[model samples]
Target: MTVSAPIASRADAGGGTPQALLRLDAVGRRFGDTVAVDGVSLEVPAGEFLTLLGPSGCGKTTTLRMIAGFEHPTSGRVLIGGRDVTALPPQKRDVGMVFQNYALFPHLDVWENVAFGLKSRGERGAGVEAAVTRALGLVELEPYARRKVQALSGGQQQRVALARALAPEPPVLLLDEPLSNLDAALRERTRDELRALLKRLGMTAVFVTHDQEEAFALSDRIAVMDRGRLQQVGSPEALYGAPVNAFVASFLGRANFLPATVDSVDGDRAACTVAAGVTWRARLAADSPRGAGARVRLMARPEALTLAAADEPNALRARVLDRRFAGAATFYRMETEAGPELLVQGGPHTASPGDVAGICLVESAQPVAYAAEP
Candidate 1:
């Protein structure tokens, strides 16, 4: 059974020194000739929600399976609370896992399903009843406790699965794309509820998802993976505002990459020339080298480029090509006189197609720069 109560008393529930609750040291997994996960090392501190985010076939699911003891790593160690449990089976690992499919028993009611683990693990009589009730209440599903799994809505069924997994209150929770099966709106709502619930319980969790928005919404930190390797790991803001590479920048959010040649460097900022007369300042990645005549890429979000007066500094003459109207924002596709296309985000555009305008890069907004791809 999952360990519901704290295994040991922590100094603080959620605000301690951020002790490592889970650690993966150089973990690797191989399936025949294919390398599923390659030398991934990560440490998830107590009460911090970390996400393994990537596209399909990126080894995110493989990594999560390894941690859950569903798949053994070909190399390295998996530790929980300073205990090496690399060779332990899933049941012995003290982890509660919620899979993509709810994995609920169709014949069992919500209460019985949630109570299965507890009862099987020797919890009896009043203890099993109380634990099931508490778990159902946590998911706000007590009213549906008698309902069959197939009779519930997708969201309700998700709640039941969550309740079942949480009934054991394992010190660490492993969720593998738990919301992926729901509709978009339900997924959003469920993710919000999941984040709120985990935070309230101060539970340490490792979530895996390919949905960038979901990862940003629910994780304290995200580890972006690609092709069986970790690309970057950081807080949502840090990853979005200051991506270490092109993949991280493009993967995290919408970014418009502009090719440039570095003209000069001063400290963490550099001057780059995008065109014959268009020179702009951009922030370099923290560990990137500063040098003259270096080829680099400047990344700006759609919102970072706004309509400006024709005479404004760093403004480029462009003609609107198309406009996409989103609910809260409008995206404009424009072609610059300097021969580059740009996307600018605004609300209710004043300029129509074929209208010439000045698109200015926000001077104070330090766009992220990285070494250009070969």
Candidate 2:
């Protein structure tokens, strides 16, 4: 049976019922001659988990800072619950921010740390104590309320930081690489914990990370950014199944791109010639507007390709150059006689290096195709 629950701390009423907690309308930012962000618009619904994902220097962090009121946009507007707050300061924005480095107070104990925000606002008595206890319990750090900030583990300290942010009961939480410093095991554990906590709390959140796995795991919606512009924005599945361009094709995951010319289209199915040397029927992108004689990059993820013999339709005969084992799956780099390099993946039954194998391209597996750059 399927289970259902809200993903935010307060989902029903805050930030307009998950329709939109915040929106960036044609927001742009510039530094001297370089434009950091350009005419980007995005809506973050309440109780939703959205991630800003991209490589470093791609304006992901700058976008988060703009929402935090730390960086002002060159143009466009920043809205919180549909109210324009482009010129508001951080304090007036009512947003809690978590940094890559957990910025906890070394001088304060766990309870004190969580209560710091309330204390600063002159909140006293049961209100302060109730908020602190509730925040501590949400992060599962109630047992460590008396622990010293410097004495906790990295993961624990990070939770404490999250609890501290939550104590203020902000409508939105912004996380900037909050788990980067943890070890592999801890990272995985924290990732799961954060997901559960966000859901249980029904709290709207925006997370920033360059890690694709992290973004995919934590975000209900992901906005892929590159070089000061949003490449694509959608659910992780949408981005993976239908990327827009070559940059996005290579970034999100492995893809074998074959130069192909469209031969014909029978509704959604199109027969295209690959590498100008072979013909294969490919499934076109969903809602793809371009068609017929348009030079396109035929793309397939590593999981999509299979090794096969020469003269086989949608198949490639090549010598395996290298093999890398990735626990659950194995990756193979194959070199074709046509000089086109392809990446192929096989599960536990993958081939070894130096083997001559015929790679199979699952005929039914259709990937998004992009217009080749001239």
Candidate 3:
């Protein structure tokens, strides 16, 4: 997957690299006194799947609307294929949008619904038919093209919306939680199908969702937003492994934050004392305090911790409080002697509730330390 970068121009300064097909240059929007989006800039290379991920009302949907020309930005520009389209209307822009509701016409059948966009653009007769056929074929809904959208399943209705969007052959596609209506099992299967369909079509897509798992599964790169501001943008693994801040760390997954003080700093590493004489070496984040004695919090994911012998080096003495079986893995809730409770993910039936256990960071775990918030 191609990673996204902040490219202001069509290509790099030297014009040696492939141009970004979509660019949002410091775009912003306001609803009276409330800022919906603030100075969000991003560049998406052709065929890259970029997801805007955040909690509710974090400006992801607003950003998507700006790209789709449904809403105009109060400041900055929107560009597609290197051309500024900030002032263009929805139909004038070469982009397709799959709305959250699927927005299928109840009166129309799948074939007519899929042909709606093409027909609205003044396509006539066989041209419209061919485009609709091709779009349905792409989504493997050709057999049900004559079926009314109301008769289709939630997953199939979503495909009709996608087919309608694709019939226009837009270079850029915008998806706004297209799978939100489906059941959990169906959503998972549909997302896989959606990603495969988009990749096969070489579509440059911008997806908006609050679900981190969906973002992780579908995106080549994720742009995390918060409080109407862009926080960080990177590949899923990059963002998950080395988040820029506490918000990103906690939002991307379950993180255990232990209050600690920095004992020392050696380059990018920090020795942090979580409790009296209990020090753990952690990777220092960019904004982490450098000097010794600085208050900080050590962050470790549940999966990064393992059960160990009580006397093992760097192990924290803990007692298993409870356990939950979760299919492939079991989760253990433990309270450390250091006063912090931690969650650890391990194999099945390792320890039961009331069992005294030792919690240690796994070898591959490089815990991060962040300067404690005021």
Candidate 4:
């Protein structure tokens, strides 16, 4: 029988710290020679909204489809609330699903579509009607309950779709780019509304989206993927402040990679040489595997590098390559004699195309090392 989505205190539903509700253990999927998802593993806590974020062909959607049972893993397992669901069919696994297309029954009114699950379960009468009302109310679409889905606007249609999924109150909700079809304005509005609603309802949801901003805004934790491989999974701050490698540092935002050779070490500060035969001191984790006399790459973010008056300390003299005006910010790309092209953000500096300036990287900014790939 359909029950009101449990009103229990859920972390996102304004309750407590959310706990893991789903886990994918080294899950993988392959089609012939092309792998869709590679040994991807992650956990989503109950009532926490998690998003799988990546670019096209990054296997984020494929991962979501696997969880929805549209595709099966070629290897590994799917666990929901700690139980293995790797072999379960879509219907057998009590999961609520929202699709990118807002697939609603054209023939059925909003109320009917919301109640379709209950009807399928052989439910009848007042209980089904009450559940349908509650679901519609949840999405603030109760007024349109009797309207045919075919007659609704895209936003309205999506609301109906959400109502349908929520009506059954499944232990888990799977959203596959649910707001991708909406316009930018509507998309932002809907995303915020959806996040709040999911929180208030205490729903354990897995959201899939390619928009970095969307993932950062809506998710409690984000799982980043690339070429079917899980890249990094953490809060947005964690991913931004401490990226694990070059790909992550580059993908998450702009970065400057300067080639340096270790001169000496003072605990974490390794005197390293950059381009132009200049040496700079950089901090490294004590446990860093980098050794003296070895070539290393120094990483720092745009904000970390600032325009400096003198070419001293860890300063690099750079010639401006390009300047881009991006509304609230202007990013400048400069070619440094000692590092890969560096990007600087958020200063209203209007340096002409060929102006030269000294750059300063805040101490300990992007103190990371990459094992030089063989």
Candidates in order: C-alpha RMSD to true structure: 2.8, 3.3, 4.0, 3.5
- What do the candidate models score in CA lDDT, each in turn? 0.86, 0.82, 0.89, 0.80
Estimate, for each residue in 1-374, the C-alpha lDDT of model 2 and write its tens digit: 11143434344444443577789999999999999998889998887889999999999999999999999999999998767899998888888899999888899999998888788878999999988998888888889999999999999999999998888878789999999999999999999999888777677889999999898889898999998899898999988877867677688877788777787878877777665356677767654335788776788888888766555655666898888889888888988765778888876455667878777767667755666657
- The number of the candidate with the highest lDDT is 3
Better of 1 and 2 by TM-score: 1
Candidate 4: residue pairs that collide: 13-199, 19-45, 19-46, 20-45, 275-338
Every model's TM-score: 0.93, 0.91, 0.94, 0.87
Using lDDT as the yardstick, the better of models 1 and 4 is 1
Lowest-sum lDDT 10-residue window in model 1: 2-11
Model 1 regions more than 4 Å off: 1-15, 286-289, 309-313
Which candidate should be chosen as best, given TM-score against the real structure? 3
Query: Which stretch of 10 consecutive residues in model 3 shows the poorest summed lDDT?
Result: 1-10
Error of 3 at 72 (Å): 0.8
Better of 2 and 3 by TM-score: 3
Task: Report the C-alpha displacement of residue 203, candidate 4, in angstroms.
Answer: 1.4
Off by over 4 Å in 2: 1-17, 275-277, 284-294, 310-314, 347-350
Is candidate 3 or 4 superior in TM-score?
3
- lDDT per residue, candidate 4, 1-374, as tens digits? 23345532433455556556788999999999999999988888877788898888999999998998889999999988677889999877778999999888888888889999889988899999888998888888878888888888888899999988988778889999999999999999999999988878777889998888898889888888899999888998898777766677667766777777777877756777776556666666333446788777777778777776445655688888889888887888988776468887647775755888778766656556544444
TM-score of 2: 0.91
